[model samples]
Target: MTRLRMGMIGGGPGAFIGPVHRFAAELDREIELVAGVFSSDPGRSKAAAGAYRIDPARAYGSLAEMFTTERARADGIDFVAVVTPNHNHLPSARAALQAGLPVICDKPLTATLDEAHALAAVVRESGLPFAVTHTYSGYPLVREARARVAAGAVGTVRKVVVEYPQGWLAGEASGKQAEWRVDPARSGLGGCIGDIGVHAFQLAEFITGLEVTELLADLGAVVPGRALDDDCTVLLRFANGARGVLLASQIEVGELNGLRIRLYGDRGGLLWRQEQPNTLTLHTLDGRTEIVHAGGPQLGPDALSRTRTPTGHPEGYLEAFANLYRDFAAVLRGEQAPLLPGIGTGLRGMAFIATAVEASRAKAGWVKLSV
Candidate 1:
């Protein structure tokens, strides 16, 4: 199959997630970055494109220019990756879709629930493939956990506990990433919930195949002079009669990307940690436990398809991120690919963020999800 051409928006100089997106998109060599508007500033956009060795002609000053110019070219981008900050996600994605290109976006879909719903409507009207990069869901072991739960290997999912904690924002800082995340105008209604909390929420749902029906949340701005929450905890009720607890914090004092999820069912239970992503622990009701490793015999075809290495070889964050790009590329190439989080997941995540904020303001009382 021919390599699919791709373009990017954002991930310019000193940006964290932009480079991660570049690495992940090219990891499997199935897609190539042929065009981009790397930043809002024209100079930085040109420089970033030069650094990536993209043709200067393909580097544009803005998303509008990029979409218009690329669509007119004989060799246009197959899809556009929206790696901008949360505030720009909706506009950039809408532009790409309106230009008749597919989109791969970072979560939580948009800066607000209203924008998310509008974007979702555009996606449905356009009938193009749209993927939301819920990075953890792309892990082979995570897929295994999902498949196992779906097959009743853990009986019926009864409870879920997911937490993502980081200490980077524990104190007052003035970095670009930290600044925008704490600004309500840029990051939307919920801060911590919109940032890492959505990932924890999505992981629980993705693994257990359950939808959150109601939730109560406590959101905190642990650092001084912060306008948005940096720590949050939520109690969730699922449609399948299961219950869940979610905690996402950037003020844990000594944590570093520590994301972990545990699911309990009637017959058994399972645990997975982002720090130790290659392994999953399965526990039986009789006090027996088994350690399942990635690229091992126990994984089903779905997990194996996403795994790249042998039993002992390791795969981590970048690989998981690439798996989403890989599946999107497969879909573009007319190959059957496993389901990836898309517009629906993105919409739900935004709804969760909005609902959590509302619930927190009401003294953490329970609130039903509007979506």
Candidate 2:
């Protein structure tokens, strides 16, 4: 199959996510990075294009220019990856979708729920394949978990516990990450919730295949003088009457990228730790406990479909993210692929942020997910 020609936006010099996106998109050899508008500055954008070995003519100063020029060309980018900051996501995505190109963007969809909803409308109306890189969903064990839940292996989910904690901002903030994320103009309304919390929120819902009907959140700005909340705990109520709790923070001392989820049901319980993502723990009500490892014979189709190596080989974050790109690229080439999370999932992420903010602001009461 011919590789899908993909372009990038806002992943230029000193950008954290740009390199990550590039690495993931190129990992499986199904997509090729043909062009990009690497930065906001023309010089830096051109320099970034050179660094990535992109064609000089295709590297433009802004996303609008890239879209306009690409639309006129017969060999334009088949898809565009929006790796820009939160604010620029909507515009770049809108341009690509309207120009008859597919889109794959990083989460949280947009700065606000309204933008998310509007973008979702465009996707629905255009009938284009749009994928949001909620990267955790691509993990093999996570896919296993989803399979277990869907196959009735876990029997009626009763509760969920998901937590993500990082100590990158343990003390006074500095560097490009903290600078842009702390600013309201760049990051969305919620701080930690909008950042890593959305991942946790999406994981709980994605794995369980349940929607959070209502939630109560307690957000904190542990670092004094910070404009946004750096830590948050949310209590969730699912539409199926299940309850859950989510914790997201970037100020936990001594912690670095700790993400874990535990789901309990009437017949059994499932636990997955991100640090040791290759294994999943299962405990049944009848006193039987099992450990499921990746690449095992018992592995379901969802996990096996994306596994490129045998047992004992290490596959982690980057591999998971790459799977999303591979699957998305396959779908873009007019193939019948598995269902991928796109604008609807992105909108759910935005809804999570909005509900978390509302719940945190309320007088200690539960707030329903408006979506």
True lDDT of residue 170, candidate 1: 92
lDDT of 1 by residue, 23-123 (tens): 89999999989999998999988889767788988878988898888879889899999998899999999999998999999998999999999999999
Regions more than 4 Å wrong, model 2: none
lDDT of each: 0.91, 0.89
Per-model TM against the reference: 0.98, 0.97
lDDT of 2: 0.89
The candidate maximizing lDDT is: 1
The digit string of per-residue lDDT tens for model 2 on 210-268 reads 99999989998889999888999999999899999999999999988899999999999
What range of 10 consecutive residues in model 1 has the weakest lDDT sum?
Answer: 330-339
Clashes of each: 0, 0
